[model samples]
Target: MSIKKSPESWAPNADQDLGPVLILEPEEGKNFWQPQPANGHISVRISPDFLDVQTPFSLGTQTLPAGGYVREHSHPEHDEVLHFIRGTGKAVVDGEEHAIVPGKTIFVGRNRRHMFVNSSQDELHWVWFIQPNGLEHFFEEIGREMVVGGEDPTPFPRPENVLEIEARTAFAPQPADQRKPD
Candidate 1:
């Protein structure tokens, strides 16, 4: 398989000539990975491929409409950093409450349970960053952001592959025999 490159893909040849790294606004029309809505909450401007190195990391802006609430969820394989840019909200991390507002940065560790609640009238604008490819492909597959208002969308980290035969033998309650053993 061949790796596809984007027009904005960094070129190694130009790395040397570029003197100093400068900050610039993200491309407005750049296409981004759209994840499936989890509940009733909506996530706009989802970009999960901002920067990838040893670990596939991403950074993107997000807006949680007024009264939007994210159901309890957890990231099993990656950590997340959220920087609130507009509006105000609160995050329940591992049962601890933390207020979220512009200039506030929250770090969520992998496998740590958390949820976001927006009580302010203004839409919440925040920059979210994830490490080690957190739901990047999954979001791309489903399309549109995952909006969950009343349901939990948390899922375990799925490794590349796991054979059913091995899973049955490895885990307790072997159902293979009850289902007409092969």
Candidate 2:
């Protein structure tokens, strides 16, 4: 998280490629999270430069392009606050798919298995807030925190996992999905 800059750094390409060039390989060292895509799930950390703040709770944006899917997964340590800024999608929690659209917000509690898919024609953009602070940093600290073979629990249904069943819930339903979540 280095913010050093030169006096002329912002002067319209005056020092192109001079300030910082970052390359993070999660396998190479600390302060990085290792990520792997499996089955229908794909996710990537928004790069250090893209991060607005590097401490406490981490804020980042992710995309689930049309036809893309995030396999069932859960956060054991932190609850997540997700706000969909664009497009449409469906989130599956407790074995149910709930429709999602622009302006929709969904809160998935810690350790709850959940998955999301873009079922619409456009790409889905959502900002994620990881609570209890520094979710990304913690992931980096533990080497690889989220992935197909990682220790984090998958949101998908697994006979051996024994995920606690909770009353499924949602923020609000899109006009298309008539049934409301309680």
Candidate 3:
């Protein structure tokens, strides 16, 4: 059965680009295998790939295996809001540690340092949304391409040129310790 498009649509995108997702059907978003340590996956839900930055914010969903974590990092040009939708975790935002649980929303301003660690027995899931439209591109650049229902790939490392990718994406992560206050 075919799903009908929403009666109203957002502005059209360039001919080659898909338009903003008014309704995301199954298998609609771009998915990728998250690099090792986290060893999970991310789905780019909405971004400039579909809509203009002036209107649509970038959005993605990520899942992390037990004991997985995201290293400390910062986005110099964009603010981020993460909604903890599943599992429990610990979030460090600018040196402050917070408990993460379902329904908890975390706001990280541009240039603030942060990290997340999953402390649950099950997979941890969250929605990563950012202002000005761009996070999805960063994820895509460092992530290995994967399709929904495909076999999961072996755990992998970040690209050797991850620093360059971070530069291009406005991410400003140094070694976690280096960024912490002395």
Candidate 4:
């Protein structure tokens, strides 16, 4: 049996009508994946620009090769959530380390230093969401778009305007002491 709701409950508002549904296939996203310089990792931004929503969050997927690690950093203005989909890794949040695997979820509060390191032989796959939006623009500005099925170009140096971008985004770099032993 179906139940009826009040007109206000079912009605679409202006805010809802302003956003359109977006469906991005994996193949379509692969073309936008950008590899991190000097790191065996790639990321595909999935939201913000994709849907152009007015929401406060952005989404993206990242694949980290075995032994790859993201340098520790923190967002002074936004919180981050990461959900692991494959492989194993270690997440250091505020200098505390936790082993992570498929189905594991992590919540990092704003201004907490965090980084991820792939420890398994295979790739680590995860989707990350950042609150208050805008981080995707930083990634786009710093990362080079990867060509599908083609060799990656030589890693480009960090953008000269990184500090400017960081100031605009409230992204703060942190010194990392978590590294896989040789």
Cα lDDT tens digits, model 1, 1-182, are 12244333465664444322223344431223222222222232333343224445655566666666554566656788888888887888777778888999999887677777777887777777777544444433333334333333433222233223223221122223222101
- Write the candidate numbers in order of decreasing lDDT: 3, 4, 2, 1
lDDT of 2 by residue, 1-182 (tens): 33444557565787455534334344322222222221122233443434344344555556555665655666656688888888887888766777988898989887776777777778777777766544444333323334435554333332221222211221111223332222
* Model 4 regions lying over 4 Å from their true place: 1-18, 30-38, 41-45, 154-157, 173-182
Give the distance in Å from residue 113's predicted Cα in candidate 3 to where it truly belongs.
Answer: 0.5
Q: Which of 2 and 4 is ahead in lDDT?
A: 4
Q: All candidates: CA RMSD in angstroms?
A: 11.6, 10.6, 5.4, 6.2
Best by TM-score: 3
- For residues 1-182, what per-residue lDDT tens digits would candidate 3 score against the true structure? 12333333432643434433355765678888878667788888776666444465788899998877887888888889999999998998888889999999999999998888888889899999888666787778888888666788848888899888888875876753743211
| Candidates 3 and 4, the one with greater lDDT | 3
Query: Which numbered prediction scores highest in lDDT against the true structure?
Result: 3
All candidates: TM-score: 0.55, 0.48, 0.82, 0.75
Candidate 1 off by > 4 Å: 1-54, 145-182
Q: Sort the candidates on TM-score, descending order.
A: 3, 4, 1, 2
lDDT of 1 at 20: 24
lDDT of 3 at 48: 67
lDDT of 4 by residue, 57-152 (tens): 787787777776776778988989999999997888877889988999999889888888887898888888888877777766667777668675
